[model samples]
Target: MHLYLVRHPRPIVAANTCYGSTDLEVTAEELALAHASLLPVLPKKAVLFSSPLRRCRELSASLAETLGCQAPTYDERLAEMHFGDWEMRSWDDIPRASVNAWSNDMVAYQPGGGESVLQVAQRVRAFRDELSGLNIEHAIVICHAGIIRLLAACEHGLSIPEMALYAAQKPHKIRYGELLVVDC
Candidate 1:
């Protein structure tokens, strides 16, 4: 099945910084944007799922209602990376030493109270297993960029650097997770 892994729209935060697992809600304007733009074109056969976070749930709930399906099943395993101490901090504010540390060991390094990339990947793999046994064929998993990046890494065995690059890519477009099927 061709899964439509939809990402949540932007939050009302000030700048574009890492807000992993943070509880930020989308503004009314952004919500309207999703309804006007993505809602009409959403796949009919898609069953919705969201990370437990409010941002993802907001997207998933609207899509599910539009599709006339049941409310989404949320998975904490699918939530964004636990930013811990850096939950709401700006990237520029984080000391360069810490940034360099994360740069070097994205998979292994954990910030104070936060999780590592590899740790999140393991959870993504677990979520993949859970998804495999679910009732739906095509799933629309609305989640954050960090979890999405780790999902890509878990499926393809991408290195830390590659995952980092993936996260830095253009947002909104689906960064592929696992290939649900191979044509060959």
Candidate 2:
């Protein structure tokens, strides 16, 4: 199975905000630009799947407008890592100790009471496993950067720990609204 892993467009948040899993609103103009940027690269028809977050859901809707595919399937497994108490807080304000812990062991550390990178990777793998049995040839996953990185890492046969490291490497990290294609 081939999936087009698409990160949601730049969210309208303040700089340095730690808003993982927060339901931030996305502007329609941003969504429109993302749709236009994607139209050239996206397959004409494919099943659409998205995180329930407004950013992804709104982008998925825009894609559906051009692709004319069925309604996007909202999957919780595709959500960004939940940042718990850190949600909407400025990144600079998060405790130094917590940041150090996450940097020390990114896969295992759960910063700000949030899920570990490994935990997010596990659910992403679960989503991939579910996709394997489906009858579709092509699918588009409108999700977050973290989820896209994990999926791309898995496609390269990286272990969970290695996946974290892989994601941290410069080239492996995806930009907002960027597309990463992987075969499941």
Candidate 3:
């Protein structure tokens, strides 16, 4: 039940637009940083899975190259929040009222065609349950901050607020992507 929650590398995008689930290119520098930071931190053998988004794909592939292996499998469950009409659009483009609504209660906000935070958690839980049965000693998931946020909140039983803080402060290689030890 060890997991390395990897936030995908940077993407080439405009300053304020959201690119959830979008096809975006990773920069050479990002790939370089991934090599420098994540590769050696991984075990000699590990299971790597990435969000289907292009940025995550490229990031995973970069690490795979460093490890001299093909990129691991793609998992749709790891994809970012489907922002629906807001895909690739800046926050300003989304109605301020709607944004405020989501800020107050995102659980009920499913704009355009996007999913709510709760919905994302539901899917992540299913994914987590599937992982519970695996013989994988180490598993790496290259996904969005939202995915990490939900996993921390639901699986680890942290409140949503605490999960937000954890996600904000944690780096890409959390605990050097180590398997955690809990007495409980």
Model 1, residue 55: distance off in Å is: 1.1
Clashes of 3: 0
Per-candidate clashes, comma-separated: 0, 0, 0
Please write out the lDDT profile of model 1 over residues 71-107, one tens digit for every residue: 8889988898887898888888888898888777656
- Model 1 residue runs over 4 Å out of place are 154-184
Q: Can you write out model 3's per-residue Cα lDDT over 127-154, one digit (the tens) per residue? A: 7667768877767777776776666555
**Candidate 1 lDDT for residue 125:** 71
Q: Pick the candidate with the highest lDDT.
A: 2
Q: What's model 1's overall lDDT? A: 0.68
Ranking by lDDT: 2, 1, 3
